[model samples]
Target chain A: MPLVGNLRDFALHDFLYLVDRGYKTGSLMLNRPSTDDAAHLYFDKGKLLSVVRPQRRERLGELLIRLGKVSPQQLAQALQTQQMNNARPLGQILVEHGVIGQRDLQFCIQQQIEETVYELFAWRDGEFKFQAGQKPAPDDVQSLVPLPVENLIMEGVRRVDEMSRIKERIPNNDMIVRFVDRPQEKAANINMTADEWRIFARINGRSSINEIADKIGLTPYAVSHIVFGFITAGLVEVTRPTGGQSSKAPVAAQAQRVGSTPTRRSAAEPAYVEPPKKSLVARLINRIRGL
Target chain B: MQTVKMVISGAVNAGKTEFIRSISEIEVVSTERKATDETRLLKKETTVAMDFGRITIANDLVLHLFGTPGQRRFDFMWEILSEGALGLVVVVDSTRPETFRETTRIVEFFNEMRPAPYIIAANKQDKDTAWSPDELRLALRLPEQVKVVPCIATQRDSCKNVLLELLYEIMETAKEG
Candidate 1:
């Protein structure tokens, strides 16, 4: 089944993160009911391949002509050659015809993709559906190298001023920031800007967002915004620092393990102790199945 | 009698009450009250404290189901509820994207406060707008090992399947240890 929802509930950047992490090959169809307009973005194994809007389905050859990279006659000749070949793409035909350089064509395609995605960031409310295994039209695939969505996610997040959403997770500047377990594996794909990198370096599982901001000389909002990105990327998890807790204690000490024991104990709470034995778990499984 | 507890938690109106009511042998004991906050916009009555339900495995073995309060003001109750639990089932309003962030916060809290085997129940799969389980896994930024089960909490079989999935996860952890 296609993944379907509205942009109001899951924002565009959040969807991009989903696509990137899931390594999904699909076409995301977006529609603005109020404006009666729609946009389509195609991805190949998580990298972006193209963006098309119903109101403005400008062809690559037309885009090249409009940009003065190829004259009308050059595009017409390229189109005629493409018709004869039929198997090759228009951009490839143009490059073979020496009308446009391969580098320039790729640059133009990337620029177009970025522009369309950036424009999509402004959409506040719209319905989005992602159909898996959906491919862009053969002719629509222009970029030799598919655009990785990590940078787009970062840039798109920067454009959003929804501090309210960030505040939902961060809550307060006193909240301590710490890396999630085994972050390096996931962080390999993520590319952080210098501003983000500075914040990333300061996460020691002990420093509060306030302490990190104070140490780096950046405002708390700036630090939190970048930390939000980190959180979104699954590089870290945030928690409120317990009062009177020694800073020297390892965060892992607080990182509770599931089967062996409970990490945080309180006087008011019940022991609720004992990790179930395998025999007991088997009985519970049987009982639930019988139900 | 010996008992094991499994906590069912989610944001407001994610179907916690219905989930418990569907599977519990007894009518779920709940502290539901008329909503006085923004939750009023979603549902007329909200779970303010917690919901309690039970299942009998044998005469001596019973399973306790605790549904954590959905609203943030009642967050203190979560710490109390999550203690030494066998596993956790985090229900997400699959049809409501706005609540996805809130769902993530709940997952983080439980994982931090009392790390245990947990599975996500993508509730409301009966709705056309419900995000697929695969999509919720990504949107929630859950690791690959964590299971995201498709669930319609009103259905008994679906709720039972969610419980079974959590039990299987706990079984794996127990064997590994």
Candidate 2:
């Protein structure tokens, strides 16, 4: 029998605990109403076997590179070899070329799974359903160790707390975080993660959070995660953009590529925006057809 | 003065940023980051939020071009940006047939959103492997009213032409409205 209910009635963490305690083998799904996207967790018995989310297809090679397990040049070389012979997965190619060990690839996969599961903690309002007796394919089980639900719940709570802290300081991606002057004594003892330091070195005030992340070769999420820590510690200042020049200046300054003096919008041009309308496209098509 | 806000949307690496940069009078404001997962395999960086760019017309009209992030996870941004926009331009990489379904879904998503008119820019026409406009039209199964214009997003003249085609459609849409 399949169990179905709103997440409001039973929280995701509770549901996960129930499944784990029951020692059941099945797939648990959450339909997040906010994004209209669903998250699927496949389990074999009491242990979590894997996770599937909407539009999430993280490649092993890419995840490895992001985690600093392999260099970009090494990935390129492995890719070239794969193109020539064209027989194996990129992860296999990397291992065969000796760019990364099998153990490292396994670690990245595990981390990917953990991150995917942790992300679901953000979906507060959703419908959850569990269908029993469903199992993942044998191939999907490759090198995957059974993840205990106790660990996931604890980690998920930590991530949720961290995320809310980050969101409080960083409203959206365009908001800029600048390095403020730190007291000399406090600066000496400031603890910073590898990612935090990388983001710290690039904070020039003019660059938005997005630009800083691009320069450091990290995702905005990774950068923001660290910046959030800095914000909580009073080590950095986040400046909310007023939706205009403060946001556009850095781009304009760096855009020497534009080649010539570009004129701004003339005074006569009004920044008028239309009101939102549902089924506007369908209406236009009908009006155009004179139907 | 007249103005239009058109969204430039497509799958990752379909050249949404490049297309905006090709013709915008100023540097484009982008919310791009290093691709973390499978998407990074195709391109090193991906847009997470929205990209802002613009072009000026002779009649004192400013076209505010907002480029929507291509990845499906950022689909919510598409809804937010598409609201109140006069038009949309769906740019698809003609060289990659696999991205067609995503492009179709994005187009349909917008069509369901509002009464706004849109054009499909069949980008990467410079590459020999790219599909021609007619083949692309059939593959996408677009209605006869929607125009499919072949474009090379990196080329200034090509990008300008595609925007011009969209401009015409917007004019017709305004006339009807």
Question: For model 2, what is the alpha-carbon lDDT of residue B13?
Answer: 81
Best by DockQ: 1
Per-residue CA lDDT of model 1 for B41-140, tens digit only, reads 2442333545656798887777878787787866656765665579999999999999999999999887767778899999999999999999999999
Candidate 1 structure quality by residue, lDDT tens digits, A79-146: 89888889988898889888888899998888777767866886889999999998877766346798
Query: What's the DockQ for every one of the candidates?
Result: 0.11, 0.02
Weakest 10 consecutive residues, lDDT, candidate 2 chain A? A250-259
Q: Model 1: residues >4 Å from true position, as ranges?
A: A1-274, B36-47, B175-177
Please name the candidate that would achieve the greatest TM-score relative to the true structure.
2
lDDT (Cα, tens digit) per residue for candidate 2, span B1-177 = 334467888877888988888876654345544435656524323325445565554343445677776767656456556645777889999999999998998887777665576899999998999999999999999988889999999988788777767766765645323
lDDT tens digits by residue: candidate 2, A228-261: 7666665567887655525533211232321222
TM-score of chain A of 1: 0.55
The C-alpha lDDT values of all candidates are 0.76, 0.67
What is the overall TM-score of model 1 with all chains considered together?
0.41
Relative to the unseen true structure, what is the C-alpha lDDT of residue B38 in candidate 1, on a scale of 0 to 100? Answer: 60
